[model samples]
Target: MPTTEPGRRRRPRASTVIVGALLTVGALVTAFPFLWMLFASVKPRGESVAYPPHLIPSEPTFEFFAQLFNELDFGRYLVNTLAIVAICMLGLLLMAAAGYGFAKFTFPGRDALFFLVLATMMIPGQVTMIPSFLIINGLNLTNTLIGISLPMLVSGFAVFLFRQFMATIPTEVLEAARMDGAGEWRIFFSIVLPMSGPILAVQVVLTFIAGWNSFLWPLIIANDQKLYTLSVGVSLLNQQIATNPSLQMAASTLMVVPILIVFVVFQRYVVQGFTLSGLK
Candidate 1:
């Protein structure tokens, strides 16, 4: 047994202290932009671009947000964003099921199929945009929220991510469940899914962030102002209110804050998923 002597103080190594200080500085630097966005969002129009920029606002108000939601019809765009995000989440369920099959089932050409999927990830999305648009336009889905979400329904990365995480599960446990007469669906839903909380949370947060931050595809698919997502709308600030840094900060804040909250809620599970999945 290791025992500390009475009245002895154990100090951290100098290297440990130095590393901690460096990491703290790095984190502060990384967070500075977000902090500035939050502070600037609440500041009056004049303070947003004030010289010798103030870290804290002198007079904080919610007028920018009010203008955004009330005068500018930002709420419609926010609703569109939520709708698109929800549709994307529904698609994630299907992708996760595909991942489960890829990870667990042994079928002819399975490896080849998965390899093809992974290879697709390397291809630039720009190459496929025109073809995808033609297909969607052929289906008469242009200028609709569903059109915006249609292309995002399939993601090779999502399949790969969930496959890796699910592969870490013990095969023996699944076999035992089968011996007890559980069907494939039963085992997947009742056993596999319950134990896959960490990975599922990870995927959910990833999908939310990707779907929320997505700009180009949504812009290409939907032309109606009512169907424009927050990301798509925020990007048009150059043409609408290009000079107002305050409104820009306010819009950016709305876009980023939800993602931060989602990440915070799932942070523990996300870390756990990565740590455990790597062990396999």
Candidate 2:
């Protein structure tokens, strides 16, 4: 058996303790706003902003929630957001598959085309915003869910992540599948896709979150109040907060809860994707 120095063992133990403390602090900082929002949302309308700012309400009430549902068009906003996210996810999946094919397979001008696509990511989104709006307007999609989802349907980030992941797949596996008379689509769907569990999970979580939180594009395209996304809806709630603080908190609380749930469920995949992508 190899003998370990006491000093070396202590170094690792000390490192572990430091990491744990940092993580605990980080978690508390991130969670504080969410905790505050939840507590505030349940408090009585006037008490939510009472002097001294109670962390926990002495008397909790659902009046805010009831007001939000009855007076605000929150339900319509939620449905619009859900529809746009669903469409964006479907389109992003297709784009990811195309990027994977281009990265992992051979074709004429594939590298040139992908590089061209990648080059566009270097351009600021603001620069293209007007042109994109014009195109959507020409298509008569503005003020619709399709318009809200259009800008996000094909993401350069998603393509980049998918391509990087697919590049790591073994060439031998692809060749073997080809020799077994598997078609290109079949190989992608059956063999390569089955082996891409980690990347797919990462893509799904990232894309879903992006679609869920998208604000600017949706704001520009969805001129109708009925088509507002969660972020835009929350911003509108901020406008009403002065008069209906409790209801505003309830709306904000509602907007954040779904995102929190998604993060908790897919945090592992989110971490893995970020780590792996960073390495590349």
Candidate 3:
């Protein structure tokens, strides 16, 4: 048995050092574009495309942001985007309920039904896009925000996530609630939903990001400028300001900030949900 001297630290293995070095390099490489975007957003339009491509802006200005707000209907787009997100979140609750039913209840053909839902995930979105559009059109919902949000309300992935997470919940707990004279709705709303915080957070973050970044469907469904989401509106902005890199970067920054804030706020729950999901 070898004994280390008091106060002497063992040297780290060469493999550990190499791995640490690689991770540091990888982190820097991943962060470089975002850092460049941040710096570029503050730079003057001409300097943004300078030959040297300075990392730090020589002259920082908020003119690009001001121009973005003043020259565009960004406020209306933001509101539209928020409304879509809210509607999609409501749809997620329905998915959660469906998942809970699949997880907790015994019914004939339940497994077959769930299999069908999972199978939908394998089909390409493009395959159904035309059919979905025609249905929305038939309902006279085209050019409306509700039409844009219609398809996003229930996602197969979200239902699967909820089912996987809810399956881990002990049946005994639900039985106890039933023995206490609690109704199924009462137990689900008061007990199961409250206990589903981590998974719910995961769904919220995923749904919000998906709704926020959705472009193709929104573009197809909404020809009205007032119903345009940030994603579609930003693309229009990009085409108009193609020559002004600073303005483009500013718009990009605005688009990214909300996602960053949402992730930061709920990141802990995401990790916890991922861990729990792996167990089930």
Model 2 TM-score? Answer: 0.87
Ranking by TM-score: 3, 1, 2
lDDT of every model, 2 decimals: 0.88, 0.80, 0.90
> Model 2: how far is 214 from its true place, Å?
2.2
Which candidate number would show the highest TM-score if scored against the true structure? 3
Candidate 2 segments exceeding 4 Å error = 1-23, 238-242, 277-280
For candidate 1, write residues 28-104 as lDDT tens digits.
Answer: 99999999999999999888888988989999998989988987778999988898889989987788788899999
Per-residue CA lDDT of candidate 2, range 15-78, in tens?
Answer: 8999999999999999998898898889886787688788788899988877766777777877
**How many pairs of residues collide in model 1?**
0
Q: Candidate 2 lDDT (Cα, whole model)?
A: 0.80
Per residue, candidate 3 scores C-alpha lDDT tens digits across 1-280 of: 9999999999999999999999999999999999988889999978988897899988899998888778887878888999999999999779989999999999999999999999999999879999999999999999998899999999898898899899999999999999999999999999989888999999999999999998999888888888988888779975665578888888899899899999999999999997887643
Q: Residue 92: error of model 1 in Å?
A: 2.0
Return model 3's CA RMSD, one decimal.
Answer: 1.8
Using Cα atoms with residue i matched to residue i, what is each candidate's TM-score against the true structure?
Answer: 0.92, 0.87, 0.93
- Give the lowest summed-lDDT range of ten residues in model 3: 237-246
Model 2, residue 182: displacement in angstroms? 1.9
